[model samples]
Target chain A: MNVKAMQKKWLELGVEVEETEYAKTGYDFSLTLPAEKVHALAEVMLADGFYLVFVTAVHALPAIEVVYQFALASSPRCRVMARTAVRADGTVPTISDIYQGANWHEREARDFYGVVFAGHPNLVPLILAEEDVDLKPLLKEEKNLKDISALRHLPAEAEPKEEKAPAAAKKEPAATDKKAAKPQASN
Target chain B: MNVDVIEDERQHQFVLNMGPQHPSTHGVLRVLLKMEGEYVLDPQPVLGYVHRCHEKIGEYKPARAFMPNTARMDYLGALIYNQGYAMLLERAAGIEVPRRAEYIRVITSELNRIQSHLLWYGAYLLDLGAFTPIMYAFDDREHILDTLEDICGSRLTYCYCRVGGVCKDIDDKFIERTRAFIERLRGRLPMYEKLVNGNIIVQKRMKSVGNYTPELCARYGVTGPLLRAAGVEYDLRKAEPYSVYSEFDFEVPTEQQGDAWAAFNVRYREIEQSLRIVEQALDKLPEGEVMEAKVPKKLRLPQGDYNCSVEAPRGELSYYLVSDGSDIPYRIKVRTPSYSNLSVVPEVCKGMMIADVVTSMGALDLVIPEIDR
Candidate 1:
């Protein structure tokens, strides 16, 4: 599914979806939702034949921002990035039940940033030792941390109205379009 | 061969630690195995023995300064990691690389990929109790390392690629040598086919072992040859084209058997496909400067999440870079493919024989540092 249809579907789940330029940003759909709807969105993505790309978190001003990326495994490739800001206690509901691949990613996020995946089964330290569970080494210092708004790449007013023009396009998608124009193997 | 023996009559399972030291486990990975006689009940991989916290290091330095660290994770496919990180920064900062530079990047990276696969082929065969193939595979790989070292000036971990483009340009001698190397590898392929792939014993060992379905790969997010072996024709180069890969015409090899043998064949055929890419890239090598002319000295990326996925030899290697409008990155997430690829082993090896577990894990072509990082 393209961004427009997915945006409508995500909106039905009561979240605002931002359609980003595939040319400018690596992802086509960007959305931020509450922690509860992550599993729902993951189910929809799994139904759409998308695979979990990676799940990571960043330490920002308000809270720890957890980001999940999914990409369509089939043709007419599209990437979707869904983010959720953790609550005061840095807890978000786990989607490991939906995507088994998310289990390790969730653990890695927990190991690095201390963002708890509330219901993750076997949520032990993945890339860290058991002794260093509270290390949270990737978290930024207070002076170095930036506000979430300052880290935003897409402004609300700067949404691409002209999608067809090549000047604003990034190299990868344009290259993919060129390849898609060619005759590919039926398999 | 130490196994836990319980005195209780009902207890049938024994625990076995596979590595963090064993030679076959490959590079400091430990798999805790629950076994009943020769059959494995559960194989849980315990990681982090080699964890260097590469992400934390990515935050402290300038974006360009962390180039060498990317090479260290997947040392075999180092250039591809460097390419991914460079492309992520280029896309984030809107830097344009010259056509010549892109061609050079593809050519060198493909050569690097072929060598990586060759090493995996040799090492995997060795793990499966064959020692002669490693000699042949390393003989071919040496030619690749020599050609690359002529330009990149390194044998293993090459930080040859820079942020905007590559650090050095390829000379005419390099092209001539690479063409000769391709021809030599093509000539040697038939001998390898006869000695390895055509051997009945090898086929018997791998055929129908470690069987998995396409659904299992999708559920676990497996990519590269393992996914292709299960009949998913998804290669990052072809599916999501990056660099000058669009210019090359090649096939994404697939096998429907979905077993260790099929995965082996898929990777073997990829060597031919990669040869086609390198030949095309060298033929289309353009004339110009190798590096971007106006790359800023201080590489400050526009604040946001920027990511690039490149087809590493093992699988899709992606770098998710987040900048805070400063020279230093806010957070850099290296999503190595082996992390996902290795996660599927427990499921695939659930009811498999203890001996066949070596074949199955070797077929995945894991680089442990890449997983631990």
Candidate 2:
């Protein structure tokens, strides 16, 4: 399916899908969804001729935001980014079964921020030693962490006005772990 | 004394370790091989030997301070890495590079690409037990290094690129030397084609070895010459057209076989195509300042995430920068090409001869530092 059709499919999945300016964001489309739907999104992306570009995470207030980027390999290239926050238990579903390349990426993410990929076949440390897995070197000190709202540079046309507030408030109570997201700042 | 052997449940199956030191495995990469005699049952590439946490370093340093770290990731294609990071920050901060600076980036990056390919050509042949071709390849590559060294002022791991533009400008002598080096390298290609590509032993070893389908490559997210060799024709330079590459007329050379031979031919032809781009960029070289004058001394990116990808020699080298309006990046995820390129090892090396494993891995151009970083 083309981009429009794919956008409709994602909208049907009951997630917030926003198209952004490629010049500014370097991504044609961006979506924010719950962590559970990422596996389904990965399946749809793979079927739509999109390849996994990279998988990374950002440690922000209220959530550890897991990010996945996909790009169309062919022409009229469209780049898509899907982000989901880590669950309260610090686990997210693995897309390794969907995209084999994600296996390594997920492993690297786990090595850095300690966000576990629940179903990854080999979730061993990819860039760190076995003993150093618990180091979680990329995790920021509490004073240095930023709010999720402050980091997303969404385009003006697609920016949501007040919907983000309630969603973030609900995200705060469940995630109070140290290595995961800190408590939500007052909205 | 008891010997601990890692034996598979199947009869006569044993595990072998290949390098963090072995020559054929290249640059500090270890492959855990599940072998049954000569055939590899599985080749699991164990990485992280040289992992310096380059991305973690990106978080600690200021935006401009991280420039040198980019080159350290892939020393062979250092300039391309520099260009990727520089363009990424430029895009984030809305810094416009000069017209002449873009042309200079194109010329130098393509030259870096050719040097990377030349080294891969020689090193790959050495992995296949050919001694003489490396000498010829390095002899040709030295001219490229000299030309680049004149303007960039470093042989390898060059920190030439800055946030908005290059650190230094190229003079008339640099241009003349680059032109001469381009001509010299162009003359050497045909002989390489005749020497390596036409050899029957090389063909016998390379052809039909490590064959992967386009769909398989896409599934694995493989890019660069390996993907192009599979007939995908998906080059970031052609597909995305970053750094004034759209103006240059050159082909993304491809081969249909999807084997080591095909990858070899694709990279081989890529050298010629890079030379074409360098020549075109040099001819169309604009007259202007190389550095943008108005860039802020204290570089602070707006609050957001910015990502940009450029075609490195191994594949798509991308930087995902997340800034919280700080001079220091909150997080920077480096998506190095070799990491993904080598991820397909277990699937590709299974049931293949042990000797062909080296050829296949060599064909992928595994840079351990880049992968580990």
Candidate 3:
């Protein structure tokens, strides 16, 4: 399949192809499709005789990139990678309807990154505990440090030190006289 | 007399829990079998007991670090997993290995193949209530392991193959030892045939039992000897040749029966072919730099997804890696052959006896850790 024909096919389906890069390896093209058109794009790929290799997600700084790889079984050498980025908040369409093999991979993705695939039949935890599920472990660590700093600012550290307390006891009378003299200044 | 009459009229179907501990179940696998007087009814396999979450660990480790970890998943065919991971990294990074390194890889892989088949042959016969064959198979396997261990550091989990090439080169003495072992194996093949292949009882138990058609084989993504037994000539070494397999001349053995007997025969013949491959690789061993140019201290692959498949003893083992041009992979998915091959057991074991279920499952070579991982 030529790039022009594939691009036309995607355009006909109302899927906007953001970019297409040719791979130096055996794979011909790498297509970046919109998030909404993932299911439709997968349907087209399957119809064009592509086998689902696997699905994976990458945690980019601001957004999460979900990549689905497929290849023609007869021509196993040629590969096509379709990527779509969803917000880090976790919202994307499911491709299980197109390829049954995506069932386990999607469940795994959901377990690790908290990516929610809409219309997935079974969305329960596959590899991790449901009760302890945390979407952001790194963010949790940052919040923990801020909580510790706030606790330290509560005037609890104003108490006298042990050696200073002994010295202050001897000078208590003089300190009181000085306080009385500097009352206006203290106020 | 009245009690006896009532007992005779009672229902006989009962449930039996086989393993999670049973020796026959192989590793931490548990099968819930519904039985009706020695015949099985709907054996539901309960997995996850041995799941170590290898993929999760691989996600954190660097691409090169995954070489050692690959062996732990399928301990029986550890070197093949090691080779598969190393080969994928080599291909992804476009590292060129020398001709001698390729030959050595072939030699070690073939030896690993023999060891795997011997273990499979022994264990399969043991499922049929024969114990002596396993001992015989182990005797031969021990020699192969000893030879491999001498060249590589470890015995079972051989972290031998590096990213670009082998970790160390094998001297002429190692090559001579391997050649002698091949000759010894050729002489012992007939002995194995006489011991188990020609046994009347073994034939009765294996022949015409647990037959899987070629169409079902492909539908379930079965490969290696099991697919070949069903008459699909789809060995990755031939179909998608890798690691100097194209230069070597050997046959991909196939059996038309597609039964337990056929699977057994195919594996038996494959051992011979593997031996032939090792001999050819040894004879035509080239001399050159074993390792490729030194890779970076901190290796990072380009942002891409790569899927590579290799022929393991059980079937086709595929590793799908998604790299984001980072030290750690974004995702690592292992499509283990045992997982797919074992999934079709319920479909095949529906009408078979309890004994036949064990036979069929064993013939499939259900490595529970590989499946559960």
Q: Which residue pairs in model 2 clash with each other?
A: none
**i-RMS for every candidate:** 1.2, 1.1, 11.6
lDDT of 3 at B155: 86
Please write out the lDDT profile of model 1 over residues B1-373, one tens digit for every residue: 1133333467777999999897787899999988887778788999999899899999889998989999999999998998988888888888898999899999989999999999999999999889999999999999999999999999999999887789999998999999999999999999999999999989988988877677778778888899899988899898889888888999999999899999999999999999999999888789999899899899878667787888899887888888767889888999899999999877788877888888899999989999998
Question: Which sequence of candidate numbers ranks them by TM-score, best first?
Answer: 2, 1, 3
DockQ for all candidate structures vs. native:
0.48, 0.69, 0.03
Residue-by-residue lDDT tens digits, candidate 2, A1-187 = 4778999888888667877777876888888889888888888888888888899989887778899999988887889888888887778899999899999999888888888888888888878888886778888887887778778774455543434432322433356565545312110
- What candidate 3 gets wrong by more than 4 Å, as runs, is A1-187, B1-14, B36-38
Every candidate's lDDT? 0.83, 0.85, 0.70
Q: Which 10 residues in a row give candidate 1 chain A its minimum summed lDDT?
A: A167-176
Question: Which digits, one per residue and each the tens of the lDDT, describe model 3 over residues B239-348?
Answer: 66777899989998989888888899999999999999998888888888888878776776654556677789888787877665566766677878776576566567
Q: Which stretches of candidate 2 lie over 4 Å from their true place?
A: A154-187, B1-10
User: Candidate 2 on B170-286: residue-level lDDT in tens?
Assistant: 999988988998888777778887888999999998988877777777677899999999998899999988889999999999889899999999999999999999999989999
Task: Estimate candidate 1's alpha-carbon lDDT, on a 0 to 1 scale.
Answer: 0.83
Docking class for candidate 2:
medium
- The candidate, 1 or 2, that scores higher on lDDT is 2
**Pairs of residues clashing in candidate 3:** none
